[model samples]
Target chain A: MLIFEPHIHMFSRITDDYERLALAGVRGVLEPAFWLGQNRTSVGTFVDYFETLIGWERHRAQQFGIHHFCTMGLNPREANDDRVNKDVLAILPRYCEKDSCVGVGEIGLDDQTKTEEKFMAEQLELAKRHDLPVLVHTPHRDKKKGFERCIAIVKEQNFPMQKLLLDHGNEETIKITRDLGCWSGFSIYPNTKMDPARMVAIVLEYGVERFVINSAADWGVSDPMMVPRTVVKLEQAGVPRSKIEQLVWKNPIGFFAQSGRISEQMLQQPARANLRETFDGNSVLRGQDPDRV
Target chain B: MSRMHEQLATLLGPAAAGADAEFAKVLADRSHLPVVFPGLPRRLGRNHLGGGRTRVGDATIDLDAFRPCDLAAADLLIRCEASDDELFDLYQHGDIEERTMLLRALHVLPVGPITVRMFGEAQRTNMLVHVEAALCDGDLFARTVGQPGFEPDVANRVLLKLAFLDLPLARCLFAERHANPGLSTMLQDLATEREAAGRAVWRDTWRMIGLAPTAGSAARLVGGLEHGDDGVRAAAAEGLLALGRKDLFAFAEERLPREPRADIRAILQRCLA
Candidate 1:
C-alpha cells in the first residue's frame, strides 16, 4: 500500500533515505517546519529554513519520487525566545500562503510556557487566516501536559477541531484526542517514542479513524522506515490491508486537504520525477545522466 | 497608467485591469500594501508577466525575475509613491517571496541610502533564492559595481554565494556584462580556496571572469579546454565564445576532432563559428 508520511523531517534526512522511502512504497511526505534541534538566534534563520522546506527541499524530494509538502510556522520551542518569537510570528503569514505549505504547524506547547501558549494561539489564528490546518508538536518532556495545553489553546482560540493535528501522540494522549473531534498523530520510532509494535496496538484499539502515523525522524537517532515497519506489524496484527492503507494514506490527506491545496486526487498521481528539470539550473542530477539513472 | 500598469493590464487582460483598480482603492490607505501584498499571487494568479526592464539606480534589471502578483504588489507600492522607509519596513519583515520581489523590484524604485540596508537584508538570508533575487536581477549589486558607496562588495559575494549554493551563474543575467577586475580577482581566490579545501570549484567561475580574466582565471580558461570532463570543455568553449577570446577557443577547436561528447562538440563548434 502507498504510504503518506505525515511528519518526518526530510530536511534532516539524506537523499538515500528518500530512495529508501520510495523503495518502501511511501508515496508522499509532509515535512513540517520545526526547530533544528536547537534554538535559532534570529528570524532570518527561520525564514531561510522555511524557504528550504518550500524550495530546495521540495525539489530534492521530487527527484526521489516523493511528493513533498510542508506546514510553515514557528515551533513551540522557539516561541519563548524574545529575539525571534514575534519576528517569526510576524513573517509566518506570507509563508502560510506558499503553495506547498499545507498547514501552520509544529506550533504547539513544548516547554508549556505562557510565551509558548501565546505563539500557539497566535499561529492557530494564522492558520485560520490562511485557511490551513495545523500540526501541533506536543512536548516530548512533559507530553501529557503539553497535549492538554495544546488542546486548551486550540479550544480557547475556538479553532476548529477538524483542522487540528495533535502530533507526537502516545496511547495516553490518544485517549484525550480520540473523542475530541481532532486528528491524532503517532510517530513510530526505532527505539523510543511509539515503536511499531506499540503503534500496531494503538491501531488495533483506535481502529485508524482520524489517525495518522509518521517517522518524526530528524537530527536524531530515528528511523525513516518506521511507517513501513508499522504497516508490517499492523498486517501481522491482523489489521486488514484496506484499513492500513486508510491509516497510512487517507487519514492525513483528509485532515490537511482542508487547505484546498492537497487532496486524494493530488497524491493519487505519480511523483514528479522528471530528472532533467532544474530549479534555477540546479537539478538533483548534479551531472549524472538522467536516462542512465 | 504607468508602463507597469500597461504591461500588467496587457498581460493579465480584463482580470488584471480589475485588480489594478481594486489595488488602487487599497493604495488610498497606503499602509494596506503589506496587508494585501502576500495574498496577491493567489488572488491574481502566478503566471509570469514576462521579462521587462527597469532602471534600478544605474542598472536596468529584469522585471520578469519577479512573479506577476509580486510585480503587481511592487507596482502598487510604486503607485502610492512608497517612501524608502516604507519599502525598507516591508522588505525588512517580508517573507521569502515578499523579500525576493522587493529585491528584484529595487530597480523600479528610486535609489537611495536606505537601499543599502535593504541590500544587507537580502545578503543576510541563507536561502539562495533571496540572494538570487537581489544580485542576479535586483541590480542592487549591479548598482554598486564601479559606482562605489556600497560596502563589502556584494557583487563578488553573491556570485561566490551562488557557487556555494550550487545555483547557476546564468541566473544573474548581467554577470558577464557587469564583470570587473575586482570580481575576477575574488572569483580566482574563491576557486583556489575551494581546491585547497578538497572541494570542486564552481564550473562557471572561469566563465564569469572570462571577460575580465586575471592571470589565474585566464590560465584556467586555457586549462579548462583540455580538461578531461566534457562539461568542463563545453563550459570553457562557451566562456571563450562570450569573451570572443578566439586565441583560447583555438585550443578547443583543435581538440574538437578528438572530443567524443556531442554536447561539447556543439559548444566547440560554436566557439570558432
Candidate 2:
C-alpha cells in the first residue's frame, strides 16, 4: 500500500529511517516545522532549520525514494520566546513561497499561553496571506481547553475550517473536530499520543473522510514507522484495504495537495534513491562505507 | 440521530442497512464507543494488537469500511439531486472537510457565472485547501481563463495569485493558455519587489521570466550573476542558459573566471559550453 505520512520530523530521524520508511511503502512525507526541544535564542537558527526542511531534508528524503514536502511556521512552543518570534514570523512568508514548503503549520497553542495564541493568530494570517492550509499543534496538557481555544481562535480569525488540520487529536477531540468540519490528525507515537489500536478505533467510528494518521516522530522517544504499523493494526482489526489506503495515503494527499505540489501522479512516480547523495560535505553514509553496509 | 449520520446512511443505502442502527448508536453515544466488543477482548498493545483474540462483531466493525463506494455514490447523488443554489449553500456553510468534498465535486456540479464567481471567491481567500479544491485540476482555470476567458483584470489576478502561492505553473489549468504580457509584467514586478526587500525571489518567478523572456529579464539575470549568494548566481546562469539567450553567454563567460564558487563556475561553464 502506498503511504503518505502527513506529519513526521524526518530532520530528527536518522537516514536509515528514510530507507526503512521507503521500504515500508511510504511514498511521501509532510514535515511540518516544529519546535526543537531546546529553546532557540536566535531567529537564524529557525531560518537554518526551515531551509534544511525544504532543501537538505527534501534532498535526503528523495535519496530514499520519498517525496518530501513541509509546512513552514513558528511552532507554538517557540512563539512564547518574545525575542525571536517576531523575526521568525517576518521571514516565514519567504519560506512559505518555496516549492517544497506546502503549508503553515505545526502552529497553534502549546501551553495555551497568551503569547502562543498571539503567534498562532498571526501565523493564521500568514497562512491566509500565503493561501496555505494550517496544521495546528494542540496542547498535550489541558487538551480539551486547548482544542477549544484553537477552534475559537480559528473562528475569530475567520480562517476557513476546511484549511485547518486540528492535529494530535484523541478520543475526546476526534468527534468534535469532525463535527467542526476540520481535518482530524492523530499522532501514533510509542507513548503519550494515541497508539495504533486507538487510531484504528477512531477511523472505524469517523469513517476516514478527513482523518489522517501520522508519526509526529521527533527527538523525543518516537517511532517514524508508526504510520505503517498503524496500517497493519487497522487491517488486522478488519478495516478494509481501501479505507486503510485512504487514511494513510489519499487523505494526506488531499490535504497537502492544496499547495498544488502533491498529486496522485507525483506520488506514483518512483523517486531515485542514491545512497551516495550528500548535503554540503555530509553524506547519509558518513563514517560508513556503502559497500560494507 | 445527527444530520451527518442521516446523510451518510442515506448515501450508503442498502449496503448500510445491516449496521445502520448500530452505526447510529455509535454516533449517538460519542462516549463509550467500543473499540472492540466486550466479549471479544482483543489485547490491544501500543501500535499493534497482541494475544487475546475473539470474533469481530458487526457492531464493532469499522463503519468506514463502507466509505469508498458510499462516497462515490454520494457524489453522484448530489450531482443529480442537488440544485446549484443547494450546492452553493452547502459549500458556503460546510465545514472545511465538507467544503473540500464539495469543491472536488465541482466537475459533476454545474459551472456557470455563479459557480465561476464562487470559485473566484475561494481563490481570493488564499486558503490552500479551498484554492486547491478550486484549482488543482486546472478545470476552474480552464473555464475561467482558458474558455471564453475572464476579464483581463480577473485573469491577471488569478495568474498573480498562482505565482504568489508558489503553485507549480505546470499544475495550473490554463498557465500556457493564459500566458500574456500582462502576466509577465506582474511576475517581473514581484521579482523587483523581492530584490528591493532583500528577500529570496521564488524560483518559479525566475521560470516565469524564462517563459516570457525580455531584455529587462535578461539584464536582471546578468545582474544576478554578480549577486553575493552562490545559489542566486547559479540559478541566474541556469535560467539564462535555459532561455537560450546567447547574448548573455558572453556575459557568463566573462564572469566564469571571477566566480569564486566552483558550483557557480560549473553552471557558468555549462552556459558557455
Top-scoring candidate (lDDT) = 1
* Model 1 lDDT tens row, B1-273: 377656545545545765677487666765566656656666766666555765433456565765666556656776777778778876655555666667766655555665666666655565566777676754555555544446446656655677676666776666566666777788778878988987777787767766777667767777878877666666676766666766676687787898888887887788778
Model 1, runs deviating above 4 Å: A274-293, B2-7, B17-38, B47-273
- For candidate 1, what is the TM-score? 0.64
- Which 10 consecutive residues of model 2 chain B have the lowest summed lDDT? B37-46
TM-score of each: 0.64, 0.52
Q: Name the runs in model 2 displaced over 4 angstroms.
A: A287-293, B1-273
Residue pairs clashing, model 2: A131-B126, A162-B96
TM-score, B chain, candidate 2? 0.57
Top-scoring candidate (TM-score): 1
Docking outcome class, model 1: incorrect
- Tell me the tens digit of each residue's lDDT in model 1 across A110-199: 778888889899889898887889999989998888788888888999999999999989989998888999998998887888999888
Chain A TM-score of each model, in the order shown?
0.97, 0.96
